[model samples]
Target chain A: MNVAPNNQIPNSQGLVKGMHEQEVEIAPGTLFDAEEMVINMGPQHPSTHGVLRVILKLDGETVRDLDCDIGYLHRGVEKIAEHDTYAMITPYWDRLDYVAAVSNDLCYVGGVEKLLGVEVPRRAEYLRVILTELQRIASHLLWLGTHAIDIGAVTVLLYAFREREEILKIFEDFIGARLTAHAFRIGGLWWDAYPEFDKRVRDFLKILPGRIDEYETLLNANRIWLSRTVGIGILPADEAINLSLTGPVLRGSGVNYDLRKAQPYSAYPEFDFEIPLGENGDTYDRYLVRMAEIRQSIRIIEQALDGLPEGPVMAKVPKVIKPPVGEVYFSIEAPKGEIGVYLVSDGTTKPYRMRIRPPAFINLQSLRRLSIGHLVADVVALIGTIDIVLGEVDR
Target chain B: MSDEEKVTPPDPSGDQPQQSETSGEKSPQSAKTEASADKPAPPRAAPSDKPSPPKAAPAKKPSITSEIAGDPFIDKIKETFGLAITEAVQTLGQQILRVNRDRYLELCGFLHDNETARFDMCTDLTASHWPERSGQEFEVVLLLYSTPNNRRIRIKAPLADGEACPSVSGIWAGANWMERETFDMFGIKFDGHPDLRRILLPEDWPGHPLRKEYPIEYRDNEWTDKHIEYREVDYDTSLIDVKYGERK
Candidate 1:
């Protein structure tokens, strides 16, 4: 609601600026012409999810141009990674995409394991798959709730949070932290499945489908929700690929590429699940795609838990962890997109360069393409649709 | 040198099944212990006949070759763009190609348009600063993924301290911000980046923090003082001065 920059404009102000500004190449006798106005949307607005400041050049209500001004939350995470040891960096990875900390942890640890060529235990891989899938579901639920509230459906937010709280409870019981849980170690997990881990996940899975059904019942056919999102912010398949958009946003554009399906890692090859595709590439389609992904996540967790392997959870990693001089790129399908870690080791305990290929950071690039012609109100919905976390974007 | 020596001697050769995991741990440990030795460790005692040394010691560079004959993809790329690829190396199942900085754009265009390798997504673009390496102080790394082929390759271009590297943002739209981030962190210039301003740091911030020589805990007190307004506290008179605030 707070507009930080100057919003007031006079007719003479445009003429004063036109003298110094570059001449526009306009077709002769063009019927459509409008003066452009620039305004700042947010570095503080709640609907932006976090400090995502978008400079919007507006031609009336329609967005003429959009530029995102990020780095409000930059903590130099990559710089921090250089100083921290491989094992010490796991907790920092959790802070990259705080919403899907488990998935981020998986990517970093898996990258380190791949660099070391250490074979993780079967039990640990299965447990990792279970926890990350749960994280995907939790992340999608938070997105759905916040996205719905951004549009106007207050009821769905309540229902979504109710279910999300349950997942957080399970995470608390297992990993001792709900949000930024450093759920993984360098070689494998720090701990095996707790006594109630199986039962807790099974119970959640049993009720998740019904809860998903309730969400659909609330929003699928509702006129208000459909009107706000149905045909708004369309990104074509080819354009999405060119922009390197991933996760549900890319899937919503009908691109049939998911890292789990494309490049299977951990115990993902063992369990079977489908990557739901959206045809229209609209905000509504993206919404449907993410909702379907939650259901698929439940299916994956059920499979992983049902066939849980029994072995040593932690692999025999050296106390003084050091990797070879070569560099390795390891990626996994995070809830947001393809979260990858490109680690360069100079045969030392600390990484020479630790570059986290943040999915939200890349996926957020499509915001300009998606929100160009949309109205000011729809920009909020588009930002929500992208599902960006400023922590990862600014890191 | 000595680090490799210490890690190699501890490899349990008798244990075959767990050797892969244990050898991985020991070889790196041994390498660290024998790091000060004269000669580099010879591939870590060959516990399971691993291909390369356990770790890349500072003394020994990873062996690289320009001739990679077997793989059809590398062969085709080499055939199309002769001499552009300076060296090719396969380390731990990851294919890395070092390309000529002058011909970098053309190679990227070919890779994106080529039917066999339709690398639709420019997965990531970043740079690392190696101050110890003379002349080529920064290496810009690109991780490209061919969605159809489901293959990933790394293209690295080495540059002198302040030299400009050609940008790939023209090929992949996602590379725009990535190039900006790389420039912001490593002070490496991208020749044709659309908008190459600092993306992760303040516009007025000084020095690239990701450079190897930059300290881990650097504080920009100058910028903070310029932008942030604080109540002027006189240590001579203020009760909260360090002299009075010190605990006995």
Candidate 2:
């Protein structure tokens, strides 16, 4: 067994050595270092979902170790949360996970409301359910499109975007903005839904089920799709729970835990649906779970639209919002996973401290375990399965 | 463990002895909140391993002061590990326990393993700074949840400036990055974290930006000329120097 010298060790000629292909003739006659090759795979990559940079140590085509180098997109959002008043932080929540602004807004304002002991109207709660379910579908659509593209399924991207555009239109019709729509207040909604909000959302629900079926027909049983995702990233049931992963990733590992279902908040109890769980906990299982959740999201939205209540959306409150001194932890089931707002108010308009328990940021920690023994190419699929948004990951 | 562990006991001299006796102590503000009578409670996870509660009603009634009288976890921990719990009280429909930083891990393990208080998830761990509080200025708050009972607990341990906050990663692997992030932002050291380094900020960044003494203005950014060249970008360095003199 002839092992090449370590990179730190010098050959007879005193030329520096590093891990490289054996054919490379760096010096007169020095073999390449025996160390595993390390590849930095983002900060500017299409498959990375956002600006997430992963430094992967590889042995041939297999990934030996994975170290995620996030914070490239860190805007110090938590630090910013300390400075802004409770009302001002609404817009900032939209920036954490840009795809699911409604969910983010609900978690933050919901926590603040809990601290202040404000009661949201039943009608307002129903409206929140309707909007957030649609947001979940939209967020999952973006994830599916990019995830499929990562696995070499380009056609799914076009099909996913088709449905996603209509959801965005519904969002714009009422919320007045598309991507980072800062559309929530602490006590309740800033304004009632636009008249067209119901009709547009209903129209979207009518067509979304068929669109999802079309997506399933294209890739559900396809040989190539199965080969790429079926058993690629296998995080067992126990490891999944131990890692504190929430949402689809944890559910895919056979955990029947969803915050919306387990702890009903904001009219979630009014809707009827199933909590989808997968047994294998592989990439394919995660895909199946998210696909099932899209159908469930549609189910929730339809119920909310039909049973829409009539009342004031915004609650009566004082001009200056001041919550008593205490801390509250509010967790909601966002599309990707559980997004929690840990708020500590110091009896002032501005929050003393606010911490967001971002699902993507924590979920990314399990990537090292999932990627260790897999191929270099499979790292992309693992990342896709985790469904991380770098804005949340590096926040 | 230090011999001078000032684990504040449930002071008999304090105003806590009897819930019935405190009916007269209810303030005017609490009376107003009580008028709603049906203050909507925050959701609680239902028992029976069911994902969602079958019942349509919220978990607890809006007025949460009643349940604080018979709080089980706080009572149990006080009886079991008397000195470990520095302070325990009910707040906002949950138990807030201030545990000794030296015994934080042991207490966390007991909570994780104990039958009734099986807090399965270490949801969040971070620190907050209060410069005005002289002796115990920094407080590390850890939130835990028990999936079985559907209960949540907040453990806060206060420390002086340079004291070490013991790592809980051995008990919950997920606490790794959280502890690192806390250390990164607040400059609180975790005694035994495997890889204790900055998670969200650059490793060589100067001061803990979350500390009160650290200036919040943009002009105070400490990046040097070499870094600007290394991360080549065409931008006005003067913009960073403009103090936030105007309304923020």
Candidate 3:
């Protein structure tokens, strides 16, 4: 047994800070000698988006085999949830996938609501739909920017961020927090939607539809963009479904299993929108799905705002939420994929156990399968297309 | 946007039968034809009017509202795995089965096969520790979803400390990472998992942190000193000097 080695510092092997540089013999790959190189890509690298470490075994430019070494960002979130009150647990879920914190809030709160059997206020349901859809669009905007940039389109990053900033501002106006917005309460919203929340959302809906067209124009015909992404990282539909993939990755592979449509939650059934799926489960198809989702999210926001209900957003439930002994699993169609909160409460104010089914963690498991035949450079694109938040993956 | 442009959630009136399988329902070459000029490809096509396969479970409109106890899906599970399931109940509008660890993999396969309950996606695999139940402290929880029927079921099995549970990663590939994470947190071993190493924690980290026995705050700094790299400079003396003006 290679028992727990006492020394903490992972052997600072080949350590020259700025970059991994090995001036070793570049064995000219003749028929005789084809040496494989095992290189570590991140736990520090910028393109990884966070501290994700993937150990790749490469034969020249082609990746021979790869092992993803995750967990650098693990903060014992589930352990922490066990100790905190049910109300406090919702806020921390915001940190799981910071980009779509509203979706996280809704999933956590939805479980609690189901366990309590509390009927949410009709107005709150609409508010939840609007805020979640807005957050979905916001999250996909970030994905579009990063995924585009990963494929070497730097200009799209600037354009995508320009719109995402407005969505964050709307969040800041509503909850006093932007990225990690803890805007949900157990029974309903902690506070009513800011009066101007409607206006700002409407404003975004007006301009974003046109802006989405702008993005399509920029990348739809660009030869470099199409060639780099079109056929890269082809994940077969069976392989994708077998991997328990969800959200865009699964949809891009032509599976129409969006939870919002398959299992309606909140006020989603009332609104009208479509689930955009792709023909091929490649990087470009995933990209197309997310882009269409932004449009669909906008459509949902518009419908929700148009048919805005007028009532209190908070449900009449006890302040100190101690539901009867029971467990409930509430899942929703989050921007990335299906996010669920499995809550087990033992008639206590604090949750006995809360399991977060992070889509990124489940979706990320398919990376090794997707990256098998692709080149080393395409790995970045594959990572981007999956749109994983390390915080969620490690949590 | 035209009238066709507006895509609503599937009608709850039972107009279109649900798709049966969880995934890989589409062939590899399957991609919807590109949108035509006359009518753009609606983001979500109307639910295929194709009828679903024969199901013993009635089409109880898949809504959070109208939650019926003794769902047919639960009945099918109880009927199939009677002895294995120690406890079966309907709680919080969803069905739950608490089974023994020995027959877990068997149950998973039965669920995956189409003849019985064909659960397509294993949404999650996690565990919770109950220190009060000293003998059976760890409880592994699996959340499974049936996409075609819009049904969710939870399977929980109890395991004593250091006892191994059969791995379901074979039946559901999504179970691979999930089982590893559960093993990492609760310290319950999986019988035949491919890579059962600690996933979220360093392999050398002491004790499972999610267990109730593990201290939230480690005052001893024993585990920290052993695992965290701070060899070059001792912060203890430097912090003391900075805090109280030169610790003479």
Give chain B TM-scores in order: 0.66, 0.64, 0.62
Determine which window of 10 residues in candidate 3 chain A has minimal summed lDDT: A1-10
How do the residues A1-395 of candidate 2 rate in per-residue lDDT, one tens digit apiece? 11111111112111112334334545444443454666678878888988887777777778876677778888888777776778888888898899999999999989988888899998889888988988999999999999999989999999999998998888887788999876678778877988778887887788888889999999998898899999888877666766778899999999888999788788998789999999999999999999999999889888988999898998876678878777778899999888998887777787788889999988988888788889988999999999999888888
For residues A206-272, what per-residue lDDT tens digits would candidate 3 score against the true structure?
8998999999999999999998899998877666766789999999999889988898999888988
Off by over 4 Å in 1: A1-33, B1-67, B231-248
Q: Pick the candidate with the highest TM-score.
A: 1
The parts of candidate 3 lying over 4 Å away from their true place are A1-32, B1-76, B219-223, B229-248
How many pairs of residues collide in each model? Answer: 18, 1, 1
The weakest ten consecutive residues by lDDT in model 1 chain A span A1-10
Index of the highest-DockQ prediction: 1
The prediction achieving the highest lDDT against the true structure is: 1
Model 2, stretches more than 4 Å misplaced?
A1-35, B1-68, B220-222, B229-248
How far residue B138's Cα lies from its native spot in candidate 2, in Å, is: 1.3
Worst lDDT run of 10 residues, candidate 2 chain A, spans A1-10
